[model samples]
Target: MRKRYLITFGIVLFILVIDQVIKFWIKTSFAFDDPSVPLIGEWLQLNFVENQGMAFGTQLGGGMWGKLTLSIFRVVMIGAIIYYILKQIKKPDVKLEFLIVSAMVLAGAAGNLFDSMFYDFIFRDYFDPCISYNQVEGSGIFSECSYFGYTEMVEVRHRGFLFGNVVDMFQFNVIWPSWVPWLGGGQVFPAIWNVADFAISCGMILVLLRQKIYFPKEKTSKE
Candidate 1:
């Protein structure tokens, strides 16, 4: 069954769980706009930030409505990609690398989608800690200062849509060299991403570096 569709589905779901767990921790323990919670100094952190955009808060789009639309669009895209991956895996000349890469992509997308869809709506009640200035430091991106936190600290699943931003809490940065271009001499890596994002990056890079292993060069019509 290692070569079956179940393997791909199982792996993808596993990665998605890890991604959401980490995000849930960050959202529950910290506030947005926080650069670092000092997990291990400047090297490691549990920073909290939000994005109405794509993964890692990179691909920004329109307003809240726009983000909601994109979230729905992602479900459709991931569904299509999963279908393609399973179909390819069943082919006689299926490439293992391609199948895995597709799985990686689907997993990362699902992980982030969970937050954008139900996280803020239902899980919001859970993330909120003590409802006071001493506990949460009176900080939340939410507009209401009074209900900034849970009054009695409950964990009720909210009904309907919330459309809150996704949690991204990983920070890795590098100072660009002055001799480079556009962003030269600038600081980077404020992006707080999850493990699924890392998995997607690694999978894509591996596939690109070994392109011939997946799609070998085709002979010309002259051949």
Candidate 2:
């Protein structure tokens, strides 16, 4: 039991650290118009982008309210997953693989949740060229600022807690062929995602692939 606990903690910690490190590096070093850095030829590249809502750049709509609701939902889900893991850990028949995957999912959720809770406050100096604003003193209202060159931009106004955008950098540079119906010359996977998103996806996929092993069917009395 102690070994299982340690393994779960280690996996979650390792994933969280790697995910946050990659996100922080990309957020601080990359600019909006920077060219993508190819990792494996032109297939995979590092392209910086941010999303205000869910994974794969999906928006929940309703603007600020939507962001708040999504963040709250993530918190609730994380808590529930933790509870489930704890209960399962005490069960003699619980599979270790299940626990491992669950930990990865938890870590991924936490990594993104951390960004939503604090990135805006921490990365205020990372300016966005699209909307220039002059923040009103003591009030959160931001007035438009005069446009100059993109180089001479002011720090972005903070968006309060649970309102920061999630940083995404990795992208698959595959584009659909022009002959493809209704999907010509578009990226096969248009979404730019980060390490946290990758971890969550991999964990869920593994669980699905090995569901029977992780969850064995109980034999009936007659059988």
Top-TM-score candidate index: 2
- Candidate 1, superposed: residue stretches over 4 Å from native: 33-35, 38-41, 126-162, 177-185, 218-223
Query: Deviation in angstroms for 51 in model 2?
Result: 1.2
What is the Cα-based TM-score of model 1?
Answer: 0.73
Relative to the true structure, how large is the alpha-carbon lDDT of every model? 0.66, 0.81
TM-scores of all predicted structures: 0.73, 0.87
User: How far is each candidate from the true structure, as Cα RMSD in Å?
Assistant: 6.7, 4.1
How good is model 2 by TM-score?
Answer: 0.87
Q: How do the residues 1-223 of candidate 1 rate in per-residue lDDT, one tens digit apiece?
A: 3555777887898898888878777767776545566666565666666655577676444544556677788789888987888678778777765777878888988777777778656564644322321122222233233344543332221223535556677776556788888878776665667776787787778878988878878678974
lDDT winner among the candidates?
2
Worst 10 residues of 2 by lDDT: 132-141
Q: After superposition, how far is residue 120 of candidate 2 from its true place, in Å?
A: 1.7
Q: How high is the lDDT of residue 34 in model 1?
A: 50
